[model samples]
Target: MAEFKGLSVSFAVKQKQDVQKQLFWPNLKNGPFNKLEDPVCCVKYCQSVPNFAVASGFQVEIRDPSANNAVVKNFHRFKSPVRSIAYRGLGSGLIAVGETNGHLSVHSVAMRTELRHMTAHTAAVTGLAFLAGVVGGGSTLSAAPKLASCAEDGRCLLWDVSDPQGQPLMEFDLSSASSSTSVSAPPADATAAAMDKATALDASQTDCNLLACGMINGRAYLLDSRQPRPALVLSHEHPVTCVRLAPGDNALYVAGDCWVRALSLHQGGRQIAAYRRHHKHVTDLAVGRGALLSCGLDGLVKVTDLLTYEEVQKYEYPNCGLLSMALSPGEADCLVLGTNDRWLLTRRYESPAAAAEAAEAAKSMSAAMKDPYLKAVKAYQVMPARPEDVVAPGPGRSRRPRQQLDQLDRLLKKFRHSDALSHVISKGQLKRKPQQAAAAMRELARRGALATALAGRPDVHVAALLKFVLHSLGNQDMAEDALPLASDLIEIYAAPRELRARPGIRPLFERLRALLAREIELGKQSAMCLGRVGLLLDTSAAAGGLAGSGGAAL
Candidate 1:
């Protein structure tokens, strides 16, 4: 904490909002381990719009970007914790909520009330997916969407989500279905019936005729909306957790215990490509544009290139285990993740056009009518303007202050300690020079928030900070200024094990015996310097005037 003040922050780390959207997730300053923290089981992006839904605690929160973070009109509460949620069509037309009690309810966001409440399963509903295509193989798409849901029992049902008095359109007990008909389950025993429970469901977008559900018995039933029998059965060794069909038609992505595999529909349910990085159970998968997004108990959200099935990028939340993931509709810019904690870790990559629209909206809003979504969006780093966005300013046109939110302040406010420290170190030309880094470091230190910034990070950035401090201390001219920071480092790392074993600490802690002795010698040198200063003071009669900046630093 003290070293941050004296040394330049030439080494910093990078990651984004908790603060990026932390304002809507409840500030992390509320303590990481709250008793009331609810585990978020499901999150679903709207099928036809930008808004999304989060199933946390006993309520399903509908977050709208065009409105407030939580759209009051679309908010729906339940008697039990919501297990899954889905939206029917564009502009939040119809919403479906599946509860832990096996009860599924439909609500119309435009109507602002519950339209139907019905029993869909005997146990907790695991998932609910909307059918985007129409029935009877027509060229026209259905004006009203159909919902496909699965529960703990051997149940997978489809319903008209727009119906006021709801009755399932079709239902399935896929327990008898097997990849090879000869290898069917050995006569449904009590345990076998329960073990073959439906774990996941998905309705294909391009082919309204296609729908699929994964079972705990390691098989996925690719069902036809028009028929009673499954058109195909895809087999896996691990219990299937999630199933997703590509928009291009029939490239199904299935995730199980530790691996994710792509299966082709036209090749007699042939295995196409397999992707595995998850050491634990892969919980959910979402099909994105040219990407297949997945998250698991491994605490990683991976983005795989759709064509190659090669990992494109992965986002890690240090200690958070993810349960569900969704990519927002419209621009598909927002990535919403539901963790095993109360918070929803949302990261949005707004393109240049989106950012400008947001800025324009912010400029139009008055203080009283300020949008909370806009406020939360402001916390994140704004996307840079593209070439197409460049414009020639007209005469007397004034610039707006709508998009200038302080990045470091937002990071600190959200308790993103690691990122705050990184932001400080990344200031100015850190690699070539240290002056700007020192100034930024001093700013953080002045606020007495240095401890928060230096806590809980045990990565390369912290190692870089340690090396920066050690190098700064080697300069006799600068060592005195950095002494406090060095002491703080030892205290923070030693007390919390924040830097248990890092490249930067090897030098500082490896020669502990010699370092201790050298500290004694340094103390002796400091005493000699003070004695000389005292001699200089004696030459004048100014008692306290001579002990200015130099004395202050020491």
Candidate 2:
């Protein structure tokens, strides 16, 4: 039987049993840290990092919360007084401490390297995120992780830690001053409609590649790193206090004075949903499992299910307000609450669905890894004797195994060209350079018989035909004969959508354009040759026919 407590006891059985257990400071018996200060701002895990640190200006004493009687491992200066402490996910891994002075230091538990320090925000590093994979088919555990920091300065920096030097991979600046643009002289009433049209056009073409940033004046802008500047700017009724990227879709979730809004990743950050239940300013918002947790000066921790944006649970904390709140590494039914008093409280609750889902997930992972491709991929990962050995791994000038060749052929036939190309390239069966591939394609096209064989119904396209010819050409190089046909491809750009774009055509257009620009000098040389009396000039040939060229001419 599962036990329930508080007001939640009446519906205890309906909730799932959460597996994550709460262990107090360092898992010690009567630990070192206790009373929190004015407002607790942050909490995070330390086990994933080597030498994790936490700091807050509070009286230090540790108390054990676990029944296992675990011995505590005290951190160096664990009881030190500081302004605030912010923890990234996976506490055992890495931790960032913010001092009253505007500075942040990243400490790693495993490496003996010195603390990597950067003075970024003047006030404090308000929010910190370690960029672990939530999208691109990666889970928290499986994805490669990087460090991301958000500051009171309205700046976010993504640090590439894979490179020991900690290179800056991307950056987002939140402070964008509004610009004043004079209305250009236009037809009186049409000016408004024209501006709207221009706005829509720009929005449609915009790409949101960078994380969204909130401005001081309450506007949020979505930026693409490849573009010159921000792609979209969204206005808010009040200054945005907090923002986060959704785990699944990378959609922007922002909390402002009294509203928590979800903006679409597509359509240039258009508002998709907004919640208006919070009567006061929203301080921070955290997402976990299927629910969103928000804290405000209202002393409320509002839990809303993501699916419906409806309030699922509300708990009042014993403080003026919570500065920050975070979910456990396990995303458990419990939350690590940071209140204005500067103490971190671990509160547990009953949510049966969350527990059952975790069990199901555990069972699924316990099974053998599915996906046959990964196994084949692993077998192919061994380093060959030489780079060239990839193609002919075992012997001299070897051919690909019949089965593999058939697989490649079938993939190409099914229009899975990228995969087929990837497999061949991975195996080193084909050369990687674009030029080599182009030459091979041309040689294949010269073979008349191969073209007839591939011109099948409903599937025949210029691209497929060109690739077929290129494959048939094999090692032979025939650039001269291929160049003419390739040049004729300029007209094919507007070809039907069903027709694949052939490499043969584009190269031809490029070559022809170059020749036309230099035709005058070449034509002068041709005229000089005709005047030497060594060559007979035919009037009919000049008229674009061979008929006059063969006749007896003076």
Give the alpha-carbon lDDT of every model: 0.66, 0.46
lDDT tens per residue, model 1, 180-204: 3221222346676588778888887
* Model 2 CA deviation exceeding 4 Å by range: 1-34, 45-55, 58-92, 110-114, 120-123, 133-144, 161-210, 223-232, 329-331, 351-554
Residue 342, model 1: lDDT of 63
Model 1 pairs whose backbones collide: 2-485, 3-485, 13-422, 17-20
For all predicted structures, in order, the TM-scores are 0.55, 0.43
Each candidate's clash count = 4, 40
Off by over 4 Å in 1: 1-37, 66-68, 72-76, 134-143, 161-165, 177-189, 350-554
State the displacement of the C-alpha of residue 399, model 1, in Å, after optimal TM-score superposition: 46
